[model samples]
Target chain A: MIDSGIRLPWNRRLKLLIAYDGSSFSGWQRQKHDRTIQGEIEKCLSIMTNEDIFLHGAGRTDGGVHAEGMVAHFDCSSRIPDQNFMRGLNSMLPGAIRILDTNTCDPSFHARFSAIGKKYHYTVFTGKVHPPRIRLYSHHVTAPLNLATINSCLQAVVGTHDFSSFENSGSRDKSLTGGRGAVRTIYSARLLQQDKDCLVFEFIGDGFLKNMVRNLVGTILEAGRGKFDAEQFAAILAAKDRSSGGPTAPPQGLFLKQVFYQDRTLDHCISGKD
Target chain B: MIDSGIRLPWNRRLKLLIAYDGSSFSGWQRQKHDRTIQGEIEKCLSIMTNEDIFLHGAGRTDGGVHAEGMVAHFDCSSRIPDQNFMRGLNSMLPGAIRILDTNTCDPSFHARFSAIGKKYHYTVFTGKVHPPRIRLYSHHVTAPLNLATINSCLQAVVGTHDFSSFENSGSRDKSLTGGRGAVRTIYSARLLQQDKDCLVFEFIGDGFLKNMVRNLVGTILEAGRGKFDAEQFAAILAAKDRSSGGPTAPPQGLFLKQVFYQDRTLDHCISGKD
Candidate 1:
């Protein structure tokens, strides 16, 4: 029965922990004319397993947005060991993308649907001169920033709120939102000062809308630069309109840090944070 | 006197502190067709000053080798402020390359001729899984490395000695060596363990030959992997032949950390160490 290569009862579902530089990729989703994370991985998988593979990512990140910890899943009938998958994929995929860990999961597990939360990190360099080494990974801002005001804005982002003001146009899906209309729960939001010149904003939420993190960062930066205060930030949140917010931040500084599942404990390890 | 634009007594020599990613550049030297650090800066300088510009670097770094405190100098007749040159060059140059600081210097000072010593760093990753974010900046090796053995090799490297075993062929310049041949003084050599898996080798010396740092690092790594011991490493040095040494390490892991001058104080600050 196994030699026939038909759909067998021993088919397994595999989960992958991923990280990518994102500078060389068009985006996370596969496209006909562009190099993307999904397309590259799927092609390698098909070659290895000799079966057409479809990869489902937790979420799609925009072009040039990096990821330190991402989650994805695929089904394969090949009897290859779990560790070989990581080695095989890394050898074939570009150095910019890597499969950090792989394991077999329950058949019912879904990369997108079963996710309980996600974590993101957006880095901003407030130095006088942006260092060349981190140019591809950070956003540079020379202007003075008031951290107190930015913290206040971050405080307002906690709890359940309608984040329509931060969401961009044309990516909302009624099925994905479950008719919540741009409403989501924010578990935690805070700022980490890695150094005098590096500001890292960490956000862990139930889910995020398209371009939501970048929009929040842009608007919060305006608050930090003394364009407005916590009151205005609250007002913008209450407005629930995209036009009420500031411009979207550039993509290079953003990173999809991790995805949280219901069964896994939150790991504070700072892997791939560079 | 300033209006004529001829070579006047007021023509000042300007020193520039530069940092570049180096992954995009061919090398530090100017080439007719290839993009290089010197070529890019000279082009921008010529346009800014409306005169042909020649940049003299403290030393030439090979392609794919990064730098943080690389120094260079050029003679300019334009009376642009030192700060403006920094800003103007940074604005025109690619983000991978940056002019960190600029200032006027004595007319007699030469970038390469006046260097008293130099510092270099080589990074190696011995982790089971090399992280994707630093793949371009660090060399990855999975074999277990013995730090004690490597440190012994490093200790053996200090003091004046002939380094022919660690120098590659075809870059010897008799005028620059001053008839010293491969003889050079290593002021200090040490290994810094940044983390459990990252090993950084720091070398300070009066001068280094072509491929010397990379060659030393490659030989030291072989020692760390138990391919040889300290006595054998000493024998390799005593052999005074390139064929007796280990292979040259790749360029991506190497960084020209700083160039010392006779009068300048040694700043222990870890600027551009990343």
Candidate 2:
């Protein structure tokens, strides 16, 4: 039975933590005529449990990006098992999609609206060439990357800013189509080594605009590769121009690290902060 | 350069510790007719380095049997830098095969004949049902397994004996065809668990006869499933008849764990005294 005390006939809300390899997906959101992660998940759920599920994810990732701690929410009929909910969903999803954890949360807790923080990581592989085994998980950089130069530029992006300089221009304007706001806050950012030849750029924030993290990664990489100095990063901030950012990094290297909320107990994650 | 220590102008020997998914591979050894891991590696090397090669392996794993630390040796004309050996080999191999470690071992080191100890692991997920994500790596035993009774039966396979009973009756008998002696020593055999649902049966030995480990795993599994009495394993060994043996386990749940040597620095492994 679900967590509702008056079990057996009413709708019960549940939170699910998910992970997926996004190579074959268009994005997280569903479209009328496209292959998306949300579309596949909902289709599978409709077949397995015989319910029309409207799954809401914390963020929308582009094609070929990955997710290790994506947060989603859906409601189901009263027949769902509380302890084995994750087990049942995992049995129906494809190998690339996995439900890491699940729990019952307050009905008011929405995955997209209630999320307090989100984290993302961008992977970069070093060396003069690439390895085929790791090519799927990292972006290969032929030029030498200095960590100190990139770290200096990341320091400027660590606080609240308009962030209009680091995102797709059309998406940023589209988000404010209904006379809304466009400012957001960044908490922390750092880089890590995932393997011998691969490095990761990680960012944690209250929220992000479209393509903001990828744009920031490409900017820092330009500084690391000696194409620009930290002064250029500062100049880009002053200009508030999307074209000031470097080339967009590939989608294969980006990962949704985590999503945070107060009510969901299944928010604990292994890859990033919750 | 070879074990002879003479500078050979046309050849360079390379030794690699390899890992693979094995789900889409034919086997480790190359056949004149079939597409196998070794065959593909040779083909890719020929294309990349523009040289012919003869691939050698530590053991012949069956189709769908994975390898985490399988040792292999090959000779080619391209004199790759010692530092770039792993990266270069991995660039040519398929996504499923990865060269974990690479070294320039002596020509005298035949991966198969000149071996000391080898370890193999078989994973069993015991419960009423198992999660589909972990299903490829483990065997599902729907029936209850008695650990204590199964442990007792493992003792019967610890010493040197005529393993004719464990051999697959349908297999090509290398023992009858002037092969190495079938009597080999089992150094260690026990069940290991890294997680709750994942139970691993590890066997360390000098060498294994064709289908010996799978048959051994099947017999012990029968005891674990309570299908055969605990004492029946000893009777099965004494019968020295293939008909008395249990069923051969599926290759999907098996992995070549490691090939051990007396010293990691040496180019060759010490042969087993037994």
Using TM-score as the measure, which candidate wins? 1
**Which candidate tops DockQ?**
1
Residue-level lDDT of model 1, residues A147-208, one tens digit each, is 99999999999889999999999997777777888999887788999998999998888899
TM-score of 1: 0.94
How well is each residue in A108-187 modelled by candidate 2, as lDDT tens digits? 98998888888788999886445443456678787888888898888878777777778786664454333334467777
Q: Which residue pairs in model 1 clash with each other?
A: none
> What's each prediction's TM-score?
0.94, 0.75
What's the true lDDT of residue A168 in model 2? Answer: 82
The DockQ of each candidate is: 0.78, 0.15
Pairs of colliding residues, candidate 2: B3-B107
Give model 2's docking category: incorrect
